[model samples]
Target: MKLVKEVIARFPADAAILDPFSGTATTTLTAAERGNSALSFDINPFLIWLGNVKCRSYSVEHLACIQDDARLAIGRVPSLIKNDNWVPPLFNIERWWSAGTLQVLAALRAGLVEVFGEPTEDRTDGLAWVAFCRLVIETSAAAFNHVSMSFSSETTHHEVEHVTYLYLAILDAVLASGSAQLQGTGEVVEVDARAIPKMGRRFSLVVTSPPYPNRISYIRELRPYMYWMKFLKEAREAGEMDWKAIGGTWGIATSRLNEWGPNSKVLPEILTDTVGRIAESGGKNAPLMATYVHKYFYDMHLHLSSLPNVLEPGAELHYIVGNSSFFGNMVDTPAILAASMQMLGYSNTVSKIIRKRNCNKALFEYDVSASWPG
Candidate 1:
């Protein structure tokens, strides 16, 4: 948040801040706090919902009502889960919930749905769900070392009061902290960064920290949340989500090649370069490496294309980027992306490398890099 504020300070007060790939709407919210009109979009539906509703202004009365609703949902949790008629047939009914705990969550979810519907009713609903989502992780049976959603049967933790109280506390804190006031009026759209052009909007500043090419697969890392939202199951049933995608870790660094074919030439070049390197690697992990490169370049292309439409001429875009060595190969994504943006009709001369953190990279001392629109 502090870094975002510092970078934002360089722009004007009424700057239309935009984050084309707003993972969790960090920049979007920051813009709102500074009284700037903020717009953001993400490929993840859950994230879109989270950012959109959380950033909207809310009333104290509305928050209080949601709090009461949450309590009521908690009260009816156990019974709601046990009622066979309400359970989704495809889910493992027997293991879906830990009897009482599942009931609580289900009831809470049902109550929210009853009041506001699942997609989120208001800012308060967003706050409640955020709190609930965090609780789900902490109280879940998933392993600590593995961020994946594999539960451990040997672990036994009671989820009744603890989880409920945790959710309430978080919701209270989010509301009390004046997040709603800070957020103002903002919208979170569920769309790929590549699809930004279709939205046809422009901004004063575009601030975002896109996923580094060598970092974790974002989509895969978010499987648990996807599963919770039942999107995984829906996609699996519809043949949209399959083993290949799962194995690829939810299309983080890999996407269907055809998706990028229509885009600018930048993606194709990056993909070709990355694929050549992976082939040179020549190992079983070759496939994973190829996917990473493909996804990275494709996303970069899509992201850059959207900015031209959404940004005013010479309006600055600050990207927090990092360079990393993957499989002992240096992928100069920062320079490449900046150059790509330049090629796409944006100037790329005015930028700086502000170090926020660092890693053991002999060539570069910092993990953070800053850029301004050319």
Candidate 2:
């Protein structure tokens, strides 16, 4: 949030900000809070809902409505749990949440759906879902300190009182921090970055962070939230969703990547050579990993190439991206993107190390900025 505020301060108070890679809506909400109208796009529907939830303005009455809905929902949780009919059929559900916990979540979700049914109810439902998602994660057996997530079977899910109290507490904490008057606001659309032009709206500033070239599958990381939100139903569905996203290599996405090839001349010799080196790394997964890296850049190229259609003349873009290492070979993704921007007729392309990550001495988060010439 601090980073977004600092960058947004560089733009005008009324600048129309655009974030095509709107994960969790950090840029969108920050822009709105700073009095700049903003639009955010993401391929993930869950993310779209989340962006809308966090960016919407809430008055005192709206806050009261949310409190009422929450209390009503909590009141219904116990009755719904007594019936035990609506537990999500997530695959191996116990692997993440215990039986007692899942029942409470199911009840709370059902209760929210029932109470937040007014057609005029705007962000209330979305906010409740966010708090519920936090509750779900906090009480689960999953631990998230490392890149790879792990679970403990011996975990003890929080009790009903704990879940209910935590859910309300999360709402209070997030609302307290984010409910500053919305000086400027805009809508969030569930769309691919490459399709931004089709939205038929032009933007004055771009503040976003594209997915890194790392092999981590965002879908794999988001499974728990996606499952509870009903955005994902099965393993195959998760794989299909990941397959459609940039830099995604989860489930069947990895296998499909093996059959993928770049259709554009977006990669320069340095990256093309890096791909070859990774493929020759002498492991069964090496070839697949190589394709994963190649596809990420190609998709990003498509995204960058499409930005001209949606950005105003001389629109400034600030992308917080990261470089990656594959088999001891540096992908130099930020520099590669800077070059690509210049090749695409953008001007003043600059790549700077914005922050150094704790992992991998060679890996650093980068700020790749450029201007689109009208």
lDDT tens per residue, model 2, 1-374: 56678888988898899999888888888888889999988888778777887888778777767777788888887777765556656677788887777777777778877887521225454666777788888888888854688889676766778888888998787666555888899668877886555557788899888889887777777788887777776789888888888888788888898678877675556668778888998866788888888888788888888888888998999899888787777788987788778777999999888888755476788889999989
Query: Candidate 1, residues 175-266: lDDT per residue as tens digits?
Result: 67543476344677765566556455667677777766653455554555656655445434322332122122343223343232333444
Q: What is the lDDT of candidate 2?
A: 0.80
lDDT of each: 0.60, 0.80
Off by over 4 Å in 2: 117-124
Residue-level lDDT for 122 in candidate 2: 51
lDDT of 1 at 364: 39
